[model samples]
Target: MHLYYEVSGNGKPVVLLHSGGADLRDWTYVVPFLANHYQVVAFDGRGAGNSPSPTEPANYVADLLALLDHLEIGQAAIVGHSMGGRIATDFALEHPDRVSELVVVGPALSGFNFSQEFQEWMQRINAAFPDIDKVIERSFDAPSYRIIKSSPHWELMIDMFRHHLKKTTEWGTFESVWPEPPAIDRLGDMQVRTMLLIGDEELPDNIRTAECFRDIPDFQSITIPGADHMVTLTHPNELCRHMIRFLGG
Candidate 1:
């Protein structure tokens, strides 16, 4: 309930969960489009953006539930990007009745074994550690970020990454608790209407993750041409169009 959040327009609720290494600003371009049709709730997840750093192991799913309870929203269409998508998927799985629909953009799936190359890439970034610039530079070097680096939103993306990295230095704990058995093991059990969005230029691990959700009974998948991992920023208009269609707005 203490998490920072912004609300716009009015209709059935639509909650926006941002990607990791960024904040609610991730939804800046997409909000305007969706807000016109539905009540949009954009929030800074704990330890990201203006939200307070986690004092213990982070419980993102619980934080989301608390946010809904605080807002008195009984059910909502949940839209998430990257790590946010992971949280959204888990939330729908654990609290199906609370999620009217689910949409994941370049999502990370729990229990999906990322390729060794991806793991090494992350390890290299972590090796940079306290050197924020190096970490940021290495992060943007990933294939998934190839498009965003050249987009007009490049500086803003960098700013958010810089801020998030700096804030991590102040966190009490780095652990984020997720539902048991992992989402990969439970995708088939997801009952909420679902959609998966990915950029054509996305990393292989992410593409595979998207495939994992394809078998879900009510799932839909979209690949934004010319987009990369930062589809939210680089292709917000296209993303919103697909989302509105899927959500029936």
Candidate 2:
């Protein structure tokens, strides 16, 4: 299935990919800012938003490459968050020439061991509720609920998660989808210019993920103090500013 994507502004191509639960809208605030300097293209991944879900993760990566081929973009800078970050790494690793620069936000690891604690945590989420509303509520709240409790996006976040929950049956959703965390070995050889962005308030593992790519020649990292996993939504301006500076806008 063709993924739904939007293009904004005009200039060098810059691609934006959203996290797992959310769609391209996650980049709403930042896309316009980046569009000022680059042609920003944001798309929803398979199983999220308008994109069709596939049981395989590699298929999703192929879908992204096909999208670029369709767009006739020889190369473009990529900015991905969470699951999108993982996808970005995979894409660059497989197609080194198509990527201009890579920026990963709160990037999830690849092929790394799933800690027993994290596995138990997943089990807890799996056991939460069969009801989509209850499960979405719990999944969304598991991260930034306390800090964004007063933010306007709290309702939007809940709504989005609930909508995603309904689209995929609760029984099959969690069971079918669990990303293989990134292996530190593969990241060491990532040839692209890479930037890892994380929030101080995000999970400890997320904070440490940036350090895993020390083998990449141009790897760099930055952290936002009060922001959490959903920092892109909370600190859109700051994120856009950093990206602009890094991409030499």
Candidate 3:
């Protein structure tokens, strides 16, 4: 359960969780800025980076809980991206009082409605070459996706992608990881203050997902202009500023 991680600064703790197929290194750009005001801890999720892979998808939650237990962190803010966000939502819901606050970026929780355009976009992404190398290359070379490519953390992003793809078995990814249930309904019970972050240019469904939690008394959301789904990498400073404000650093 000793997942690879990096921590810096000295203040109230803030844990950063990477997205699917990404590692603790993915937050290289954002963590330093956040570290200025708050202690920042970034770690790879189970099955990614240096974390051990589990046979069942649900074990990820256990892995996260074990991590928290190991760290002896009683209460802390959590900033999670994509798959990490889903795990964060679950953690907050199950252990409501442990989270001081929650920040979710590009969260992919299920059960939200999707428009036709958004559906088509999902299809396109799914249809994209399943090869991680090609996907990483396309992600960088695409003109519209240049924002992330320009980030100081871009090299780490690419390296993380390469590492996951190399460590993952073809069947393990398809069978053990993909096609798992999501944490959409469980979010409503999350009692901690939660801020959902997404990019202005992101797909409509992603935006809608953020909107879905707007009515929750503790839920809020914000969108960054000129940013894509990879907002943390593309606008790390801005993202850190918002997180600092939300986390009351």
Candidate 4:
């Protein structure tokens, strides 16, 4: 399927990948900030926004490569959040020649090791009886959303959160067809400029992911004090600051 995408500005390509529940619109604030200096590309992944589901299984990394081909872009710097970050990492690994730089925010690595504490916590949570409304509430516990829960954007966030969570219930993890390998082991193979961003207030497991990549050559990481999983939405200006510093360097 041809995914829905939009491009803006006129310099190097900067592709934005939204989280699983999000569509292209999640980049609303970040896009303009980037478009001022780069050709920004934001797209709705398969089954999100206006993009229709593929006839077969979805291989997001392949889909991204195809999208670049369709746009006639030889290379791009990828910025992805959560699940989108996982895709960005996989694509950079599989097609190193096609990526110039890669950045991920609160990303979920395919085989990243979760601390025993985190794993047990998740097990406990998953073992409990499921409640749809409670599930939606739990989603807000993510640091970024927690910070924004009382803000002007709170209501809008609630709706978006509920929508995405519901979609997960309907579609499951969407991992049946196009499973990719764990990237932690391949960190040494990344050839492009790479940066990992994590919010200080985010879950402890995500914060620890930075330490996982610190030993790799040329890998850099930053922790945003007042931000969380949805840093792009909660702290776009701060996020842009790091981005401008890295991409412009």
Candidate 5:
């Protein structure tokens, strides 16, 4: 696969799909714990981290399949955060047999209409594009990041956001292709065991998204106290503990 990826530990494969505005570094805290129990495959999605900029409209789902095929991973537990969670949900719906389990952390769901407030917030950031500093400032000002902004990992988060914003300037197109009819419309079709993990202090849009996933059969949801959107960074131990228990480690 053209995407850059790293594999660690050894056991049933588990793939990590990071949130937008960051890279595989989003898993920096969570990986060490999960790696000790299962083989962890974390990669930079197109146009993020070490991955090449998209020359055409990006197809994240196809890129994921290519990664699995390249690693010869027949099936894996798919774990995703934010935008990554949206991708994971679509992937499981499109290729159910390839996903042994599905876990979405503060996921964004396709076909779920985002609140105007959230859309406007994103627009403000986009308007500051090219001026990386302003964009970064606006991005972190969201209620979703209230906790992380004061956490020790704030610098790391800023670094990733800065890096991703810089890289976006090199992209040919910002469009990303997902499975048809949207994952939100296909939740009932998901066959893999699923889990939804979120922080108590999340944006309304994300909380609404989580509600959509609740209707899925055999689904479980957990809320991490004292965490916001960046639960992976602030509560890695707790996140890993819940994940391991759910995955039956």
Candidate 6:
């Protein structure tokens, strides 16, 4: 099934990928700014947002490639956040010729071992069984939501989560999207122009994950202060500035 996607403007192809539980709406704050100079596309990956439910675990890298093919975009830059970041990295690694530039925000690697703090936090969550809203606030909203607590966008984000939260657990877990021979192990071989963005206040695991790519040639990593995992929503202008520069806008 075709994914639910939005395309705007008419320039170089630039695709926006969202985080684990988020759909394309994750890019709402950044899309118009980018559309001014890019053929910006945002889509709901399988089982997220308005996309069709998955029959089994998805090969998201391939799915993304197919999406591009469907759009007749032979080559394009990719901008992804969290789970989307993981997919973007995987795609660049798997199909280097198709990517012009890569941007990953708060990426999680396929084989990345969770930081000790994250593992402990998961254990705590299981023990306490916090409500879904509480879970999102802890895992996604925390440091960032506090920065935009009074805004309508914050409430919109929360509502989006409430709507998509059902499928997250039902579709697949961590092991679903993970293919053997993870991305972290093959970083040395990938030379795609890459820019990494991480929120300084995000979970320790994510901060640790982004650090792994720092030494790769042609790779750039930036940190946004007072932000959390969902930096696109929390700090759109700052992210757009960095992305526009890297994208040569």
| Residue lDDT tens for model 3, 57-140 | 445556666777888888889888877787777777777777899899988665556688666654555466666665666445
Each candidate's lDDT (Cα)?
A: 0.93, 0.76, 0.73, 0.77, 0.93, 0.82
Model 2's number of clashes is 8
- Residue-level lDDT of model 6, residues 1-249, one tens digit each, is 379999998899999999876788889899989999999999998888888767776779888989999999999999989989999988888898999999999988877898676687667655544487567656543354465565557776776677677766666443356555888888878879999998777766777788887755799889898777777887899999999999986
Query: Which ten-residue region of model 5 has the weakest summed lDDT?
Result: 176-185
Give one digit per residue, the lDDT tens place, for model 4 in 1-249.
378999999899999999866777778788889999899999988767767654556778888999999999999999889888888988888898998889988887767878887777656545543676765555455454666675565665666656655555554346534344577777777777889887877777776665665645678888888776777777788888898889983
Whole-model lDDT, model 4: 0.77
All candidates: TM-score: 0.98, 0.89, 0.83, 0.87, 0.98, 0.90
Query: Which pairs clash inside model 3?
Result: none
Instruction: Give me the displacement of residue 47 in model 1, in angstroms.
Output: 0.4
**Deviation in angstroms for 177 in model 2?**
11
TM-score of model 5 vs. true structure: 0.98
Between prediction 4 and prediction 6, which has the larger lDDT? 6
Candidate 4: give its CA RMSD in angstroms: 2.7
TM-score of 3: 0.83
Identify the runs in model 3 with alpha carbons over 4 angstroms from their true place.
56-58, 112-146, 150-154, 170-182
Q: How far out, in Å, is residue 101 in model 5?
A: 0.5
Clashing pairs in 4: none
Q: Count the backbone clashes (under 3 Å) in each candidate.
A: 0, 8, 0, 0, 0, 0
lDDT of 2 by residue, 44-147 (tens): 77777777655543355677789899899999998899878878887888788999999999887566565676677667677887866656655655554455
Worst 10 residues of 4 by lDDT: 171-180
- Assess candidate 2 and give its TM-score to the true structure: 0.89
